[model samples]
Target: MNSFTQYIQQLFANEVGGLFAAEPAPLREARQKSMDFFLAHGLPTRKMENWRQCPIDGLVQSDYRMQREADPYRPVEEYFQCQVRNLATQMFPFLNGWFVHPDAPLTKSANGVITGSVAAAVKQCPELILPYLTTTHADKADRGLVALNEALFNDGLFIYIPANVKVEEPLQLVSMINTDDNLLINNHNVIVLGENASLSFVHCDDSIKYGKTLINNVTEVHLAPNAVMHYYKTENKDADSLLVNHLFVRQQENSEWVSNVVTFNAGYIHNAIHLDLDEPFAHANLYGLYLVDKSQVVDNQVFVAHNAPDCSSYQMYKGIADDSARANFNGHIVVRQDSQRTQAYQTNRNMALTDEAVVTTHPFLEIYADDVKCSHGATVGQLNEDAMFYLRSRGIGERTARMLLMYAFANEVTDKVTIDSLRERLANMVERRLSGELTLCDQCRLHTSDGKVLIFDVDPDKI
Candidate 1:
């Protein structure tokens, strides 16, 4: 066995029982199965088709501790602050790999929505949590990194919405990695919505410590018939951080699902998403945006499966890279033989700001049904020189003209966000990021370089 695989097995053998005693029996069994799978398959290498472009040799070779406790020197609340102005939200914080209750009491709504730590919910509502804990979208084949997550994840958020309920405000979950020690973190979350229910969820990832660390996170979402859900994810970690995030969704008849992934900074980051349209008339929309520079790498992999007739799916992703950065996008759509009258479309566009920047895109469609309509396209190029000259001719400065064009390119994905405040916040942040005025540690006070917090005014017209 490889050293990495042996190290993971030893870690699990040493602490699996003591660390996860609160989990239900079914969950424990799942963990054991996952451990076995990981040991057998080990980690993926360059030979694998899906992981060829993205390399993880350095990440796997490093020695990282499994953090189970928060750092005693720093308070967790020092890292939990709102980035969006005037946006009232129920917040839950996950530090390292464990859930930490916020300073303010978490809102308990009268609409029968339960939100708290996943381990606590497993003990309180085993019937509801056990059925879907690790059962939905179970893959029987080789899934190296996912199996590792199932075996090692300690705690994350759990949100349950009852039938016929609509949440008025957005629910936010902030996950932070702050420690002086080198660490590897594993976290898992579950979100379920009942029939005719609707909810908006925002997930954010940040870091305060400058040390190198690896974060592995997994989230599963289920929507009942006639339900609607909107999900938004933002990543703004330090340049030394490594991240792997997985998101899975299952939709019933007449349900609607929309998700957006916005990435600002990271050293090596990979995002994998899977959507299953299980019943008739279900629809899904997937969108993503990433900005990277200075040797940073970002990869986005998406899969959509049409299992029922009359279902639809759409995907759009845009990225910008400069100074030897790399960006990768791979989107796959499959229509089963029994599924008829399916509609799907995908598009990927990227801009390279420097000669050393690299961007790769692959959009694939596999159809076993005759009565399906699907299309996909991808483009990679620099900013339009003609348009730049046109704006320059009008007396606009070169730097301002370039920033304006880049902002216009990224605004296409930002404009699709339904939350008005969040959309405005993203627009402002993107403008600052493109102009090289934004710092990587803007949200955390401990890492601010100048000792004074920097804030930007939101301009709705810019978007």
Candidate 2:
């Protein structure tokens, strides 16, 4: 067994009971079950099909503390803040996997919405969130990493929207890491949108101190009939950070889920999403954009299950990898035998700016149903020579032209962002990232220069 696995076993036996001894019975039972599962499966290996291309060697080698005392000297806001301009959101702050706020840990809005820390919800309003808190989601299957998160998670964020209500402002979650020592952090988030409700949410992940840390995070979302949800995620960190994230989403009749994930920087990042369309006319639109340079690495794995007729799912992922960086995308769509009239499409495209940079894409479809329209495709190549030449001939510099093309390619996904202010902010960030301006920390140990904003105009007809 891996030393980390053995450590987990001993940790569970020694502290699992004590961790939740004060919590209610259901919470204890749920965590115990997850601990038991992890003991049996251990950490997922590269031999596993879903993990074959991703390596976890660096993750397990460290003897990180499972929990740590809250850092009194670390000022998180001094290190990182919301970069989205003019995006009005009810912001919640998380420092080192625990939600830190001056107000009550759990609060109810005037509009009958519950938003705050997940751990506080369990302690304060158990009856309100009990049904979904510790229960198994039908659309989700177990994974060793996700089990690890469930077994060890202490605090995160929770957002609940009651039936038939529309939230005016988006809710923003900032998951920030700034530590003086190497540590392990596990947290879970729960989002529940009731029938006929609609809301927009944004999640940001950033690192400030550049200390080595392993973040194992999980999120579960439940959408009732006719609900509409817009979700966005951003990750930017130094090279010393390792992140593993899992999301389980379920949609009911006539519901819609629109999600955009953009990764600007990270040392090692893995994002896995499991989506289930449980009723007819449900639709999911998933998009992602990533930029990696140096020796950085990123992996996005998505699975969409169509369980009802007339359900539709779409996925588009694009990334740029430079230097010796690596980017991987794996998307799988499954249409059940009973799910007739299912429509699913997936596309992955990447730009390998250098010969040493590697990008791998796998778009798969499994259709057990007879009446289904499904297609999957991937492209791995460099910048379009014709477009580059066109720009150069029009008196544009090579570097600026290159950024323009890359920006144009990325706009396809970011343009789909529903929130207006947030969309504009993302566009600016993308430009800065392509120009080498964006960094989570003021100065990354592996990085030297910061980025500046530059405008590149391209005539659509000429290009």
Candidate 3:
């Protein structure tokens, strides 16, 4: 390991050493094993094929320490309202990587539904928490960051739904990471769904303060036979935030996994999502959208592995870049030897608003089985000028017309945002960014559906 890697290890060893020390015997031992793995691999570099487009040279070159609070605690409610309050479900709140909800209560329903923190579940029912926590996939790559999180994570979320129980309301896990010190923030989460259960969950990650901090978060999900899950995640960290997110999903027979990934913040962001189709008749749909502007950079990598036959998986990602920002998408779809009759599709499309903007896309398909049907494609280009002019012909100004055309272009993907409120919220956020109200992109005036064009006068900071 280089000096920077060694420095990070030493810093973690000295500070925040007692956080994970109280965990159960198995988890505590797993934490140490992950730390040793990091010591051997260090951070990913350009030499690695997966890390080629999203190297961490600048991250390692800068000195970082484990973050700690220097003053009083601030609640995440101060920055964002509970928009999903009417959704009627369990809500878990985290501020600066710590769970602050005092009345955070979870109980089992007679129909077989259990929900609570892993720490709490372990005490009440160890059998419920044993099969899912650190179960099988330990991950051979990216152990450094995983180790970092396992060693430091204190607050986490755990949800369980019993057989035949369906949650009508969406479970919400809201997390806000802010630091008083220049250190990396790590978090771990676990969720389990029983057979024939249905669930929808949303995760929101934002920053409370502007500071140079690294965030590494991991969430493991397990779906039993005939179960269904819909997951939506949005991250809006500060421009100085360095974020790494890992999501793992394991699906049983006839299970479905639908997930959407959206990132509109952070100076440098890296996200990896892995889905394992462990049985036949599994279905998965993955969609992602990222908006990068100024000097910010966001990288997303996804892997879908088919271990059984008669499974289907679909992947689509879109990116919009402005100023000199960068966006990278690296997607891999793997079909095992026994995964015959598997059908998989993957595609990535990116648009650069300025010549200085940079976007790189790499879509790969690995089929070890001879009878599998898999296809993958990638495209990187600018907005279509013809489409912009076509809208302008009907009295729309240049700026307004461009916005309308771009909105329609992105809508092809946004329309698939199955959730009602989230889809509208994301569409408005994209519009605000396009209008330069967020300071993440250049200023632009837009026309409404009724043909009235207006320029936004309010400043993003003021709003």
Q: Whole-model Cα lDDT per candidate?
A: 0.82, 0.82, 0.74
lDDT of 1 by residue, 296-388 (tens): 899999999999999999999999999999999999999999889999999999998899999999999999999998999999999999999
How large an RMSD does model 2 have? 4.5
lDDT of 2 by residue, 1-463 (tens): 7788887777766665566667888877887788777878777777666776767664665477766334454333444445455678888878777887765778898878999988889988888666766764322233787887877778878888999999888998887765666778888899999999999998888785677888889888899999999999988878988888888899999999999999989889999989999999999999999899999989999999999999999999999999999899999999999999999999999999999998999888888999999988899999999999999999999999999999898888889898887787777778778878766523212111243322233222332
Clash numbers, per candidate: 0, 1, 1
- Please give, for residues 1-463, the per-residue lDDT of candidate 3 as tens digits: 6876778677657643554444567766665666666777777767777678877655754466654432253343443445431245456766556555445435677767776555566557667775555353446665566666665555467788888888888887776554556656666788888899999988877665667777778888999999999998877767877888888899999999998887766588888898999999999999888877888889999999999999999998988888999899999999999999999999899889899998999888888999988888899887688877777888899888877766666666667777776676666666676666654211121122344433333332321
Best candidate according to TM-score: 1
Q: Indicate the TM-score of model 2.
A: 0.91
Candidate 2: give the clashing pairs: 437-451
Off by over 4 Å in 2: 68-80, 136-142, 441-463
For model 1, the run of ten residues with the poorest summed lDDT: 444-453
**Alpha carbon lDDT of residue 388, candidate 2?**
98
Whole-model lDDT, model 2? 0.82
TM-score of each: 0.93, 0.91, 0.88
